[model samples]
Target: MRKNLRVAAYAICVRDDRILLARSPAADGTPEWVLPGGGMEHGEDPYDTVVREVEEETGYHVEVTALLGVNSLRRTFPGRLLRRPTDHHGVRLLYEARIVGGDLRNEVNGSTDLAAWQDLDAVTGLRRIPLVDAGLRLWRERPAGGRVQPP
Candidate 1:
């Protein structure tokens, strides 16, 4: 089996009873709602990655207010590109972010297509990735150890 590892950063921006989210491509290239962030580039800092990804996916400049927690997830699944079973591991840094500027807009020619602010209570009804739930948990709980179970 092949193995894959991904390190990513995400922003949890909540204000006025809503959270910012984007319709991002899932493992199968289908769109699903997710936090406004993605994987880090080679030699890129996670902090910078979160800022850049938030802007790219949501068209908003954000300042990370707090490091919420880290969520590590692992699974074995059939790989789309390899056409074989693979072990995938992901380490995500979730941050509490404050939107400082820019307007809400859909991402063009990128991994995510649509951006929107969903009511906190309404989020449970949306088709979304686990990261969304994990991030929100971290934000609400404010875990002292900065670690959370993968949702």
Candidate 2:
């Protein structure tokens, strides 16, 4: 089995009852709506990662306001050859962010293709990534520990 771990930062930007979201360009045909952020670079702080990723994916400069929470998820799936199983773990940092500059645009030839603001109530009807729900839960509930509580 092969094991991999990824640390990522994501921003939850909401204004006028709408939330900013990016559409993943996954080649596996599982594309879905996600928050505007991605994996951190080497030696990069999660705060910086959120800011940088937001700009890259949404073409908008963001100010990370508050740490919403952290989420950890793991999955095991077949590797390239479908022979070896790969274990993947992701540690994601969720933050509340505000758009400070730039215009809304989709990422070009990147992991994500589209960026848009969707109505908060309409989000439930959209096909979305799990992180979207997790981030929104953190924002709405605001656990004292800055982490999602298992229920």
Candidate 3:
């Protein structure tokens, strides 16, 4: 068996009641909307990670406005036929951000295939990763401890 951990940053960029989002390929190779951010590099700060990821994934330069909250998730899955089971843990840092520059464009040669603004009211009806819901809760509620029970 193997254990793996991922610590990544995500942004909640809301403007005019629409949130900026990126559609990345999910585990089953289908597209699902997510906040525009990803894992930090070896020596990068979480703040820098959010800015860089937002640009790479959404072609938008962002300024991280606030540390929204954190969401942690864990899963254990069977590996390929001959391999052992693996434990995966993901810790996501959600930040509130504002777009500073750049245009809306889909990521090229990256995990995400599309980038677009989705209306806040219609988000619940979309097929999305749980992080989207969790991040939004953190953004709206602004809990004192900056933590939420991810859905």
- Each prediction's total of clashing residue pairs, residues at least 3 apart in sequence or on different chains, is 0, 0, 0
lDDT of 2 by residue, 1-151 (tens): 9898999999999999999999985557777899998999999999999999999999999988999999999999776755688799999999999999999998998889899999999999999977899899999998999877655
lDDT of 1 at 61: 97
RMSD of each candidate relative to the true structure: 1.9, 1.6, 1.1
Q: What is the lDDT of residue 67 in candidate 3?
A: 97
Best candidate (score: TM-score): 3
Instruction: Using TM-score, rank the candidates from best to worst.
Output: 3, 2, 1
lDDT of 1 by residue, 9-111 (tens): 9999999999999997777887789998989999999999999999999899999999998999899987677587989999999999999999999999998
Q: Which regions of candidate 1 are displaced past 4 Å? A: 27-30, 79-84
Candidate 1 versus the native: TM-score? 0.91
Candidate 1 collision pairs: none
Q: Which ten residues in a row have the lowest lDDT in candidate 3?
A: 142-151
